[model samples]
Target: MRKRLSVSKWAITVLSILSLAFFFTLGPASKASATINYGEEVAATAETLIGSPYKYGGTSPRGFDASGLTQYVYKDAATNMKIPRTSAAQYKIGKAVKQNELKFGDLVFYATGAKGKVSFVAIYNGNGTFVGATSKGVKKVKMSDKYWKERYIGAKRVIK
Candidate 1:
């Protein structure tokens, strides 16, 4: 005959299993929540600039450049810190991260032009693409676009 486990032992074993599951699931859920919020903020900011013309050195609704767009989005959504207003300057302001490590609110930079002289910036939307205002206006573009993929410099996390 087999002996049954003691009540206390069974309770402890069950509790431990439940605790482990809770802890494991908690981390991923929290991360997902944060991502959702970040995505919403990014989409809202992008929507606000739907028709704003892209102007070099511009910083407001009057117009915006790549970095200006990033600054405005972060400023409006973050409300706690100010970001730099130029692509190169903004690139220097955040914690450097890899392309695959990008999260919502992270800045993605690219070198445009044959000599890689012009820099463009965008906000990662937690999807496969990023959002930014350009001469065509605010829109989402694939991170893997031929030009973007070729010019991809790196990414930076400014929110944390």
Candidate 2:
């Protein structure tokens, strides 16, 4: 009986080591990870605030303006990253990309303010659509629309 018990213990140890080795080779079957795609993450975060009220200088779920929305989204979505607080400042940090080259999470600017300046900003969600906060509230708008097209200044990609 002792011999049999000893054999069983040895078998159990071997099986445990083998299981660990297998896990090491093929990776864990149910491991939690944090492989974040920052752009998609930012877009997803913005999508959750679809109907949030547009508040002047607001930056939280309670309310959000154009720059406030961008600032909050990037701060929440990306790790260890801080963005500019205003539309013009945000545009200045990112690399200038042509409108056609704009991709998901790219900041689309418009000359909505006086003097045709980059005063408005939106997050481009690809296929010529973008999400932003307007005077009405947070809503998705098409870049090809007459008003947006007329005001369209350019786009900038802040994500690496």
Candidate 3:
């Protein structure tokens, strides 16, 4: 009886240790196997347009509006995806993504005017930073800023 009890405890201990090891190992392996993100390509292309001028309906290298910039970048990345021209329309089309889950190439939207509607859009560059066109032109700004935090409406994922 004593020998049986000792063996049972050892088995339980071994099983617990193995379970813990398996749990820890599984996470990294799954993450490593994650599919390639096209957003990374879009983001890299967007970063190159940081200094471009902001033109209301511009969609080219010469200048870009908020949604225009996003449209250009994704298209430039050769994803061949179609995107809307206005910020509000763009917001309505993509998969809803929470602010906390924003990733590279994700569309971040804002309510900028007295009417407080979704009127502006930006491409998230990760690490709390996003690039957009404002009166100030194409620039990178942080969501933590007082102005932006208050205006932030939502985010959307355009890729898959």
TM-score of each: 0.68, 0.78, 0.74
Q: What lDDT does model 2 reach?
A: 0.85
- Winner on lDDT between 1 and 2 is 2
Q: State the lDDT at 119 in candidate 1.
A: 82
| lDDT for each residue of candidate 2 in 38-124, tens digit (9 for 90 to 100) | 777777777888899999998998989998988888888764469889999998988899987877888899988776799999888
Tens-place lDDT per residue, model 1, 65-133, is 778888887777744458876788888877998777777777888888545654889888776688877
In order, candidate lDDTs are 0.76, 0.85, 0.84
Worst 10 residues of 3 by lDDT: 1-10
Top candidate by TM-score: 2
Scored against the true structure, residue 77 in model 1 reaches a CA lDDT of 73
Position 76, candidate 2: lDDT: 82
Report clash pairs, candidate 2: none
